[model samples]
Target: MANWNLKSFDDIYSSIAESAYKDRPNSFPKLFNKNKSTEIDYSKSKKDNEGQITKGGGTDLPNGGKVYLQPDSKKLLEDEETGYNAYYVTDTETINANTHQTYFAIRGSDGFGINLPQIKKGNFKEFNYQDWINNDAAFALTDAIVPQAKYATKGMKEKITELEEKAAPNAKMDVTAHSLGTMVSVQGLAGLSESELNHVGKAVLFDGPDTTASLKKAGYSDEKLKLLDKKLFIMSILLIQLVCSIVINHGINN
Candidate 1:
């Protein structure tokens, strides 16, 4: 988004409108190769305990909780990112499970990271279409802009409650959310009773927006939620990376 200056925006718009617009040969896709992976040194071997990173660079989520996921989930995990204006959103789906608890991860939207220069601060609405945007934060947060956040929250709450009921009595959930995923988690959880929220054990948010107002409006207060214990944030503009992949596995084990 650093290249989102007035001239660059005009260039991209022209590139889309005019096929012959070649003065600037670079298209939006060319300028930002979203497929490019972030560089970081990683251990090639698996660490001990409930989780593992397969040799293929995929995450091996932990199981042994009360919920359920695919049979092969322990052997394979993939991170899917959006290319264009696309979004990977869902109501609810199990990441992995066991007899005592479950583990679920929520992915954020497909837009620029929190570091988007245009958004000096505040939610996406403050920067762009705020008038008619409404509660579209939940969907737009996940890059699913056509649907609004209220509907998404409803569907998600239903899914979470369903999972909670299906699992063993007092079954717990360990949540990991990234970007818009954090909003989804908070909104969905806010709809649940305090007892239900207690079933949620731990949460790890990766660059997710602070949805305090969003949750409070939905009837979830800090006094109501009480789920922020053991919470950690990563890659946030104002916070440090207190939670890492190891913390994700550890959260599940606890």
Candidate 2:
């Protein structure tokens, strides 16, 4: 039940410095150079019992602009050799744009690496601690994703509540996710205030297998159900496109 509250850009960077991927598989070899770069020691993040600072802290995105975490990524400390690693990515170009900042938690297995599942980045923050545990991926899959469902649920609710608390009386927010993450996202959305729900532009989802039963019982209108079906199809196609790119990337990389 590891819970992370990423409040700043520094928080995201610190996690990456300590991640196992930096030294092992080292996915970004172009920057890390197969863990052989002399200028930077990825291992320093693991070794420093106290902590150290490093320049060029940002998540390299497929797009151009550099993403920063809340407290700076360098601030997050981890020891991958002993199984501790996490990171977050957030776009800085936009205003209050939580969509660009996504959280990731990676683990090592038997001297190998683990790829975290994709979790949707949102502005939600208000949380129901108990409900999150019940809906967390750790409770569902338990094998991979952590019980982050609560953090994510609370995060989104916070996002919506904060928005209403501030300006934008008419603006809408949406909650969406795939698989295990989807369960918590939807639960939080369901728990939002009616005004929050009204402000919710949409609740998009992808392969949220656990929530179908819930949605069915909630008794959505025919139109709402149709919209959900359409959204599902669109998400499925988008996933297929990404999956294809992954297959191609693997072939090219290997």
Model 2 misplaced regions, further than 4 Å: 1-153, 166-172, 215-234, 242-254
Encode model 1's per-residue lDDT on 83-111: one tens digit a residue: 11211111124322323544444333433
lDDT of 2 by residue, 186-220 (tens): 54444444454555555444444545455455554
Cα displacement (angstroms), candidate 1, residue 13, comes to 38
* lDDT for position 102 in model 2: 30
Q: Predict model 2's lDDT versus the native.
A: 0.36
Candidate 1 TM-score versus the reference: 0.41
Q: In angstroms, how far off is 62's CA in candidate 1?
A: 3.5
Off by over 4 Å in 1: 1-98, 111-165, 217-222, 225-254
